[model samples]
Target chain A: MGAEFYHSVHLDVELCKGCINCIKRCPTQAIRVQHGKAKIIKEYCIDCGECIRICPHHAKSATYDSIDILKKYEYTVALPAPSLYAQFNNLDDIDIVLSALKSFGFDDTYEVSAAAEMVSEMSRNYIKKHREDAPFISTACPTVVRLIRVRFPNLLDHLLPFAAPVELAAQIAVKNAMEKSGLPREKIGIIFISPCPAKVTACKDPIGNTYSEVDGVIAIKDIYPLLLPHMKSVASDPEKCSVSGRIGVGWGNSGGESAGLLTDNYLAADGIENVIRVLEDLEDQKFGDLEFIELGACNGGCVGGVLCVENPYVAQSKLKKLCKYLPISRNHLGDEVPQGALFETEIEYEPVYKIGKNLAESLALMARIDELCKKFPGLDCGSCGAPTCRALAEDIARGFAREGDCIPLLKESILSLSETISPNQ
Target chain B: MEKNIKLSYIVSPNDFLSAGAVSEDVKAHLEEMEIDSEIIRKATLAIYESELNMIIHANGGIIDIEITPDSLNVEAADNGPGIPDIEQAMEPGFTTLKPNSDMKAKGIGKGRGLSNIRKCTDFFDIETELGCGTTIRFGIDLK
Candidate 1:
């Protein structure tokens, strides 16, 4: 739970009935059933929080920073993911949100989306360089990237190596504060107001060869109720605007990344399974002249994060209207801040993912998978306690769910348990 | 000694919805074994494509999968119209499926069923008569 790793998705012991719901739906086969409850396989888990988001029993939950951490920073910047703007209802202006943020002890609020604009432009340029492809694969969604690492190791080379827009935003915010105030880096802590658990996990365990640039991640859902009390309506006057309105916020929804980056021959893919399909096309070199590809592991992208506060569809609309009028984030924040600043420069790092030929290991895993397959009929009926057919397969592989975790087998076990009881007591 | 799970199901023709049922079950079994994704994908595609072909063209068939520790062996036999041209059908995109029928939910665009099954495994054998029937045997090395 410390800096070793940040896992936002967890099984709430009290709520979980030891069902395999999360186990079945995990895209990477990261979950397994143990003692009748679903558990996370840390090494395999990318922390996408699919279990947290899909659990109807509310057994799955995410971990984030404690509100106590706020006291550590002398000056705080509320760097909200663009998706945050999409959660509220009856919000007329940005000032209310800004003021509300101040009430929560933030000295100033910076838009993560502002840096996202530069990301948009950067992505466009990167895609232009690789336009002769089906999909270039969006680097913005960390969950989607992790999914690729586990499932499609062959396509790792196709991913853009740049840090995500949120990383860029955090880097810029920290550097700007460092240069402007000359404050010690420790005194000024940057807390990412994330809409998704994947971002939180990414901040904790970065991928593709670099230490994470983010200090801490706070899911927006945790702070929404606190901010709602101080919220007020802001006039639509452009003079009061401090950054790109929703340019960065637009990144919360599916297809929003592609929309944010104005480029031709671009394909936006949402949901882990769908992204896998598109990646296959990319592997085949079928989609030529493809300038860019945006992939989000969740159905509605960041808006659908397990830790987010509201309905994904509803949040998506809010983000759309919020950024509809604001200038792109690049022009807004980058222009306001002076050029030649340290924040504008990019930092280099090594990718965290490992690439090698482990045919022996893979074969062993496959053999185990075959053994697991022998247990269930692969109905994907959510009866064996796992959510999908593939997930049940993974559960067996991880030694979480037993081969006899199948429903009929479970029933037989229960009946046997009952039969073994003495009638006379 | 573990009892050999000898189970067989007839894959009737025109039953597209249920085409992958047995294969899906087999996949679940494989997953339970903690098999690697590559092996599972190979087994899945090979069985799934064969099942799809059985429903669309063969009118129906039977599949027998033998689960063993060393390896998994699959025998899928179809009774409808046999593949008249095995060599041509092995070519990618050689299916007799209607253009619209080619589309699947997963969006796989490969044209060669036999080729795909072959590519998905280390060994593949097909025996078919023009009017009698077709039987395919494939093995995935467990290592």
Candidate 2:
């Protein structure tokens, strides 16, 4: 209703087989197979990339900046996600990856993991000061933040009000680039190498914050092959580019954020379903004594992103091995939260799942949906283009669909109609 | 005047796995109807606590929810053994659940179910007979 919500996940119509795979796998039930093609209900989409991971036809793809985007600015600084370090095999030094990024045509590189360390320090202080709020939910994962914005409004206040690591890195990258190159803000490109599509959406349409510092986002998979050759050249004499240490690089895996907090009284859950369950229980005030809740939309955290090349578990182990030799943390914020660290804008509840406009109308429509639910089979087979019988009923009540769309119901009605028109033999 | 929407669910006894299904469903429904978040939160907690009580103590029960424009009324009727002392049962940390009971093992049945239900809802009522059954009624104002 308000311009269709921006989503990084897209359906390549030419490749789509209209299979029910993505429709069933969507955590938010946003996908519907209509007209023999999967349609994402934009408002309901959190850009979790579950569809991209589940689509058999490979039709579901994420939208991101191409290699040509590097040419747009006078000076471009690549902000590599922590997950990027986990992509390489036997990647002993993080400088190898950073140097490779620079050799691959980037004017400079800033490790997002470095900024993650700063964020971790800030989060520790925030949690200590806001003990009354106790279990503050991490706002690093854009998909998790977006999911909370829509579905779990009750826990909105519990969200950590800080910019994500990549965003903080972008802000710092842009500032440093501007001072060094004597260039205007528009001339400097602070591009992020992202592990997931949700970051692309975060850059385009940010939540919690008013504006995103990152100019463009390129999927890790896209940049993975191009950087491999550069990695070999820079492996022997890599630049002094690594600023982050263990705590920062550890952000690549699940439980890493909580581990960074250095608090045993925290709960960390990964995978979208698990995150949802945590949020649901949190809303019920289940975890009373937890100091923080770290929720990642991806299974093994950023390393498990849909755009990553390596296996998530393998990547996690690689990340652990890489961090073993690094320092505890390289970045530190003594007493004050840095400027641009906190969210400038408040995240509001979207209530996208509401059935009707007002209370009276919603009640009526809900009643209608219940009545329709009684008529339709409860198999949730997804043949009617909707995920479940209840979803179809909601669609029908909203006038987007009809009961006739249900194949099984149509068959029954047709059989009864024929019997009424022509007496039984 | 809008007609009240009535929803019902049956809580199975000692089914710790599916204990919170009804409350979750009811919460989702209320969210779809665009109910006030605070009211939904209160209603969900109350319903969840009552549902757990039915599973842990009352063998099983039928939970009926009546949703109107201004309020939500819930009635959890159980045919299992009823509460012997309503006054003592109303106190927090007075749970009859043994430490090894399935619910207790799952970190629930903390004796706060009844108190929590009463604390969260606008109105709370309990009717019980030692051998016959028990019914806990609660309501929350939606406005």
Clashes per model (N, Cα, C within 3 A) = 43, 0
Model number with the top TM-score: 2
> Which DockQ-derived CAPRI band holds candidate 2?
medium
In candidate 2, which residue ranges exceed 4 Å CA deviation?
Answer: A1-4, A421-425, B98-103
TM-score of 1: 0.73
C-alpha local distance difference test of each model: 0.68, 0.90
- Compute DockQ for each candidate against the true complex: 0.12, 0.69
A57-95 in candidate 1: lDDT tens per residue?
Answer: 999877778666778888677788777767789665555
Q: Write the per-residue lDDT of candidate 2 for residues A78-154, one digit (tens) a residue.
A: 99999998999999999899999999999999999999999999998888998997779999999998899889888
TM-score of each: 0.73, 0.96
Query: Can you list the residue pairs that collide in candidate 2?
Result: none
Point to the candidate with the largest lDDT.
2
Worst 10 residues of 2 chain B by lDDT: B101-110
